[model samples]
Target: MAIDGFTTCLWFDGQAEEAAHHYLSIFKNSQLGHIVRYNEAGPGTPGAVMAVEFVLDGQKFMGLNGGPQFTFSEAVSFQVRCADQEEVDYYWDRLTDGGEEGQCGWLKDKYGVSWQVFPTELLKLVTDADPAKAKRVTEAMYPMHKIDLAALRKAHAGER
Candidate 1:
């Protein structure tokens, strides 16, 4: 494939390859592309992974072994929009496995990558034209970990 256009590069301390494999295993349409290793370079030990090219559900990404100088923060996150509660549960469970769950459907993977696994219904409910319904949905979501679509729907309908 031609190396061009936009692609996200995820920086890791020394687990680029491992993270790539883990991501590929989690997403259905994911695959690993080129994996480059460090030679007798001064930056890293020989045979250590330098960078890995991968595709997660069709989005191209590069995992760079940039050492421990930097780490991932919750400020940057990939949002996965789900059509239903099942999709939300699937991504939430998979991404949060051996990881941490944040408020309002956000989570951090084992590799410290932040992600938002939420259903589309939640968005619709929260953005409703009715201020009361929208406020209820927002209030209900504030205390959620992985997001409860059913609860959001109920809140949108003004039900407790």
Candidate 2:
């Protein structure tokens, strides 16, 4: 069952169920919830999936087997704030598998969903009170696709 309240809806070209399962497999605390199918009323073939509701680590999202009319865009993205380098690497690798990677910790999942797999230390380093530390870290990050936490930490501490 979908928990009541705001739920993000992702439009897919017939891959809603597949994407839901993929996400469920990746996130430890997530689950694939209720699914709805198209009927003879016919936006899709009868008995085919029409939508799916899933929870990824407590975040609710609805996937619509909507068709080729709409597509995922980078204007909106899911940000995964990782606890450390391991978490960042885990998400970055999985999310970028068979998908394109973007600069600065962002990548498109195999299903075209944009995700930011970032280390929590990034926020701390980037927002540090020392302007030089923050700038160094920021500059170090802008050129990278998958975040390198060790490098960022070095830059933050004024080390090469």
Best by lDDT: 2
Q: After superposition, how far is residue 114 of candidate 1 from its true place, in Å?
A: 0.6
Task: Report the lDDT tens digits of candidate 2 across residue range 77-156.
Answer: 99999998899988888888889999999899888889889998899999999999999999999999999999999999
Residue 109's lDDT in candidate 2: 89
Query: Residue by residue across 1-160, what tens digits does model 1's lDDT show?
Result: 8867788999999989999998888788998999898898547888888999999999999999999999999989999999898989999998999999999999999999999999877777888999999999999999999899889888888888
TM-score for each of the candidates = 0.95, 0.96
User: What TM-score does candidate 1 reach?
Assistant: 0.95
Clashing pairs in 2: none
Clashes of 1: 0
lDDT measured at residue 52 in model 2 versus the true structure, 0 to 100:
97
Candidate 1 error regions (>4 Å): 1-3
Once fitted onto the true fold, the runs of candidate 2 whose alpha carbons sit more than 4 angstroms away are: 1-3
